[model samples]
Target: MSLTPGLRFSRSAQYVLLSNVAVPYPARLPYANLRRRLNSSSRPRAQRPRGSPRTVLRRASTASETKPAHGPPAVSVPFDPKSPGSLSTPRDPIPPESTLNPPATTRPPPLDLPARGPDVSQFSYLFRLGKAYMQFYKAGVKAIFTNRRLLRSVAPPSGTASAGGALPTRAEVLLRARTRHDVSRLPVFGVLLLVCGEFTPLVVIAFPRLTPMTCRIPKQVEALRRSAAARREASFRRLAHLRAARGEKAAGAADGKLVAGHIARSLGLTSGWWDKAGLDSPFASSVADGAVAFLAQDDALIRSGGGVGGIEDAEVMLACEDRGMDVREKEVGELRKRLEKWVRETESSSEEDSKDKVKRLLLNHELLV
Candidate 1:
């Protein structure tokens, strides 16, 4: 049977970049001065030393340089807008070199002018609200469209079996879905489906002892879809297989046995039956019994007298390997190829040794324990 294609994220990344703006740079202060006054009053006249010719000349030179005949002092301090209090400090007779260069003025934040109306604040607020509403409307419309598409995809195509007819196996539906849809065109949609498919086997494999009566059904489809889609896009987990197993458990919880069975039946999971089940976070024997009950209901579909057809257990297992509950189509073709090789090897074995080769192999791998 054909395998599903790999999935990828869509144009949604473009909107992510558009939603935020960059922060503005801050301003700096220029040429500032600090001065400390000397207490001349503390020194008594009797304690003062007599001035020599060298001291007299030095004092004269400093006085002459400090006050120029023209305009202002040669050394000027720049004004600071941020802290006007600095202006109150007295200047020292000899200022630091920093006083020569004024600090830069702080620039005001960029003015965001409103596109409409004389009252900019009012206009800006209204504009933001309008954009928000438009975004909400777009999201709602997109969600409706996506749900409709998914429903159509899940439903059998023209001339296929009706709702109550003998359901197809999970393998058959997947093959058909792969053949009909340009999975690449579906963007993250394909990945979401893959994740949903992956969940079943992961749960079976990872938590074989836990059974499945205690998983919680997810309340948010969007969250589930987005998560699955993201996993497909970001295929870098070290233990992807293990992660998929956990996700499947979550999916089982989200899709109660009844709804899940109905969905499975609709998708043609003929090998199974749907039974009522309950899930809580903690493990419970009662919940396992509930799962057994659901599986019993699916027995009718499994026992229908139609031929086993083209699908096989290996195919179903491969689908689980590929789609896991976290990532859709992340490892689809790889698992399918592996299963196909196993099938080929099984077919080549002698009649006496037909001995359920897949089952033997799974046993060796501890996959079916």
Candidate 2:
């Protein structure tokens, strides 16, 4: 085969091109020159100055002059050899002590503002009243569940007779009595609450007796006691007037019936016992007899259980309240003392004297203290 310029044929019959005709290779270089070329090719080329050397030098001098002489004194920070970045990054300036810990400013004395008055708005009052009623309802429910056994075992107020063959303990009697009174009030109060809604407070205020012992507010309870005390004083005065009118015949059967009726009314035995017609009716006489029987039975039951002193503190207070005594502002100790006196006086009296003793005690309820 014919060969082209700068071309040769191998023994295998393959064409081998040593160099291109248009671009020739340079002559072989010396060892030193070859090494320098290799190094120059491997390294990055430096950028040339855009301006004259004098201008560049002038700029460098001006920059040096403008720079602070002592670059924020190199803060001697603890260097970690392992942290390579720490050596390159400039340290942040140290803050002054004043900035680190600012001085505490003196606060002005608090203004002597007048105390705020109680919230009297209808909505506010209603909200609080509802909360109180809810608490009262919850307490009543808990009491009912807790004393359900006792309630089941004892007869209600209307029955005035023990259900169980065994004579009930003082605690059982008190629980049964309180449960009956509270249960009676609960249904009516619940109806009022449902019907009246927010206006239930007004209804409760108008008829405080409708409120259960557990549901009565401190203010309402105090008011009720005060009113009851006044009524009790009036009842005593009426009894005195009746006795004076009867003169020497005050102890006679007719006079005694009249006295018993008055006693029943004073003790709140019946709802309409105060009506003149009801007072002298057969119903009133039966009610008076029942009241006397209930008192005598209760007195015996109390004596069987170690008298008034053996009763629980709560029961003593309840008993006092039941007997038309003013329990407001009175401690349990004071109540026990008064109740103990009444129980002892009744126990020591004869059958005839005991009836009179109960009447006197019931009329002058608070006077026992």
Candidate 3:
């Protein structure tokens, strides 16, 4: 069973991208010119006395360089040697004392640009594994179901002798089943690993906000199975408890009365509460009409009772406890009685079926173990 051509193509594209990101990126200086300017301003200025001819000459040269080169040249004005007199007034607007020598316009400290997140190359191994797994899964399932006709031929009805020595025997059919089981299981395992490998890193990096739902397909499937078992157990227990409670109520037992009174006390009581405060209620209400219809079988047994007898329903019920309406203790007890009877009946049926299977197996074994 080849992978869907599209999936393979997409996976290949991902690989190319992953590999590209792998080639190390050279360390680059994005703003070298701005950085150089900032560094130059921080140097100390010369502190030579103004009276020195060399210092005076250097200052004059510096001033000449700074002034506009195309403007009119300075004209020599007669100086009163004995009197201190100002020269031509400064033409450029005077900078404010506060602004004139403001701190150097140091380029804002080189922006501390955030580091780029890890590159996609980090996911290559996982991507490859996922691709392989998906391919195997697609093929494996197809292989098994595709040969159903062959499988049917190998598995014959019990007790009927075949022209060719009991039609390869039941044990032979089971062995073939086991082979098919491997074909099914391998792909499933591969898919599981692929899914985990693909998602685990993403969850780790994303933390709380983007955490992957831990229930991946494989884990979810396993969890579903476990939940199914728990559901079955919970149903059985609930039914048994209900039956016992109902019997006690019928017998005028104190426990039954106490439960009913407690339920009654809790019905329809509203209280002041802070916005986030939590409270517990002891009684629950159902749509009375719906409950009647449920009991009346207007819907299928599963739909009406909401899986009261099925594993699926039991699971949903457990999940709803935190959010669902409260139930009256007396009603709960009565419901439990009916469930307990149903459980006993189911168990009895299963036992009878098991007995029948064992007898059939023994009879078949006599001919071909």
Candidate 4:
């Protein structure tokens, strides 16, 4: 089927965004401006000596940039512009050859119905009539005696879920239930690529849940939302290990602002973490002169906890790192989980009570040295 139009990303494109953050989305960034941002952020702050941590970082980044490597390996963040996935230059478009297919034996099975008996003539006029009363079979002898028309209806009985209610098939009809599956497996980061190589029937598909035009838009919207939620949950499931890692380092502020930026960018964070974090603080500022990781205020009210009619403040943990991080899907899944837990405990508590909570975060949310 043709795409439903507007905001419907190509399956390959969506997979690329979800599966590989290293390859940024198709956002148009002016190369000159990005270079300036990168260069300016890369520069060292003043008042620090050449051997200071910040100054040392500048030298290392400069050295890496000056003599670029030809091919840095997976998860490499070499400063050089010549590598395949260099941070200095615009990322190359993911090649089409790399976007498609998996060998058989492992592909996700298509969403299909159990075979109907060959004798079940779906097209027979008599069969169509019977299918209409699939729900009434439960009404039993009383309803059978009450309505001759209902009794004669020969549709398959409703499944247990919708028994005694309106025909379950109404949803089946409203949903226009037919079968469709795509991607040999449940859709994930690399699934879209596989679709590019194969041709199919019964519409095996996931993500961006395509619908037959007959389905109502409201139903379509719900389906789309459910599909998106499933994908996001699946994304975190892969990172459950990151959440449980022990003894993470605190703010990493001790290392200097540049280090914070390095960690944030490597983890795919952007400027304005406070607002993104939805925390209240009196004196938070960016990690450095350029501002990738900002500092929280020494004494500020946390709106997250103080408001009435709000959800349990503990749940704020999810909101803290609500957005995705930039690092490879594998690196910081556990870290995200930890931050999520930390925000939750801190938000639910009194400021006086949360002092130890904050200290725990600084001590354990360890940054890469």
Candidate 5:
């Protein structure tokens, strides 16, 4: 013991000694501890059950919940077959005394005839309606020819007389204008009648512009007026935009040639009657000139005819329509007042005050404000 060597050695020698040594496993562990360790390490994990209590409660709550009602209220009203807006109402309802009886006529029966009630059947009604429409179409065609003849008779021989001749009477002008408008739409009306057949009335009601003025019922006329009012408002907005884009000074010039061009394009004077263009082209200027002349003539005619008061109701409506004014829901008296205002302003203004005149016609002047 007195001569025992210290355990410490040089680093290289200690590393060599440790590298050659072997560690032994413990062989004396207790059986209970070894068994417990093996059982715990080898045991399988327990899985959670499907549809647990919390999940079932959540699903039950959701299923028991009620949703609120949506959309319009459910109060039912009885349908009126006599109403003009009713789908079941006759499109062209004729009384028993009307002369347009299909049975009394010698013409052959329509190719498509409804088999129900002889007098009240769909085919009977449509046949009578067709006859009525044909009557109107025939009248319009006749008037067109008659007006053309009258106009030609009054027209001087080519190159023999000056371009200026006696102006047509107010009646002739009004008749010619109405007939031309109705006749021009005949082809389209015929096509719709052919294609739509029983449904033609519904189509015409929805698109009143497709039918001629002569064939339009009161309801269709009202619908058209409403649509015209919307279009007039749109034109006003477009004019405002144009005025903004061009300087205010240009828009308010004395001659108002630029504004005149825009007004002409809006009034359907451009080629194709739907083209949109500014005063950048010569064609626009020419169209504007034509528009101005037409308006001046109309003004002169109105003045010569004893102002707005002397014109008939139909003539008043036509004038309002031509000038892009809103004629919706207006009575004869109210329309006359509006027209009188325009005429009064125009009377005091010169021909060069075109912008103001057009503005008055369009109802876009300070009067609107």
Candidate 6:
């Protein structure tokens, strides 16, 4: 048997640039579209009666009658075969050629085969209804895939209680929806097909490789992350004490009185500022030096800087660090000398957030753990 041509039809018949022949319109004749007759069929609409055809199954038409109307004409031609005028006369058929062919088909028809006729029973209403239902079910399955949000209403809930519990996160809801079927709980065949149609195929195809792959991936990722975090924590611990000490005395972090308070808090010194003889004295510098030693050991003392600690509760930690040296120049006179020096140093320091760095240093040193 000859192969069918791979040609396709199009309703829009724009001129093709590569070929000389213009193809038919996607519907039918291409020229018909140019004349604005797009819906025209082989038979015009008016020729048919108003009612549509009721037949569900169209009977196959018999093949065309190809026999000639009359027997072949006996032509009488008397002309030289070499002359141009010989084309005007008809050539007679060869007697041997005509006699070689059989009167009908070359092979006999199969008599044993059942005859084909109009089978009214096959086209009965019940069969048509069943066919329609099958078509609808197939269409419904396709619709489920396309409109996936419908699955959310039908997904099986996990909790034991009939009443709703806490709402699931967006991630949980979306993940559950992928395999959920609205029909899954229905009284249907085997109850498995009642599950999501798409979910069924996924379980069949990917279940072998998918389960093991999913299990291994998160474990590998978590272990890698935890090990890296542990390494970083260890590295930071090594630097915390050094960084805290350096930050306190690197030429101009805070006034001597302020440092004294930090030191007294870290060393648990008698909540220093007891009277006029308190933080103002020259001995405060020595107390401050001692404070920086343990400053990295406890975050409680340093956290008293900007966020917590009260002016009234001197027992907790001092809050005067926020005060500019100008206010304490009289009580802590040495601050005047350091004030100008501190400004110059602060101007020269890198523009990083000093407060945040100090906070991190305290936490790393187990000051705020």
lDDT, residue 12, model 3: 90
> What is the C-alpha local distance difference test score of candidate 3?
0.33
TM-score of 6: 0.15
- The runs of at least 3 residues in candidate 3 whose Cα sits more than 4 Å from the true structure, single-residue gaps closed, are 1-120, 146-149, 157-161, 164-221, 246-369
TM-score of 1: 0.19
Worst 10 residues of 3 by lDDT: 100-109
Candidate 5 lDDT over residue span 103-125, tens digit each: 11111112222344645877677
Q: Report how far off residue 186 is in candidate 1 (Å).
A: 20
Q: Which residue pairs in candidate 5 have backbone atoms (N, alpha carbon, C) closer than 3 angstroms, thus clashing? A: none
List ranges where model 5 is wrong by over 4 Å.
1-119, 153-168, 175-224, 242-250, 254-258, 265-285, 348-350, 353-356, 359-369
User: Which one wins by lDDT: 3 or 5?
Assistant: 5
Per-prediction TM-score, please?
0.19, 0.54, 0.24, 0.19, 0.50, 0.15
In angstroms, the error of model 4 at 362 is 7.2
RMSD of each: 33.1, 36.8, 36.8, 30.4, 36.1, 38.9
lDDT (C-alpha, whole model) for all candidates: 0.32, 0.54, 0.33, 0.30, 0.51, 0.30
**Tens digit of lDDT per residue, candidate 2, span 216-235?**
65557667777666655665
lDDT of 6 by residue, 1-369 (tens): 544343322312333532335453452445646555545555467764444354312221222222222121112122122222111111454232121111111111111212334764644644554444334334333333322332223222555222254333222232233224322422241243345432332342322222211111223323433433343344344334445776742323444344343333332233224322423345645654443332321222222222222111211211122111112213433433333233222231322443323322323222221
Candidate 4, residues 266-321, lDDT tens digits: the string is 22233334324533122322422222211121111222222211222222222233
User: Alpha-carbon error at 233 in model 1, in Å?
Assistant: 27
Comparing 2 with 5 on lDDT, the higher-scoring candidate is 2
The alpha-carbon lDDT assigned to residue 92 of candidate 1 equals 49
**What local lDDT does model 1 show for residue 28?**
15
Error of 2 at 63 (Å): 97
Comparison by lDDT, 1 against 3, better one: 3
Candidate 6 least-lDDT 10 residues: 101-110
Clashing pairs in 3: 1-139, 242-336, 242-337, 243-336, 243-337, 283-326, 284-326, 284-327
Q: Candidate 4: where are CA atoms >4 Å away?
A: 1-254, 270-320, 323-341, 344-363, 366-369
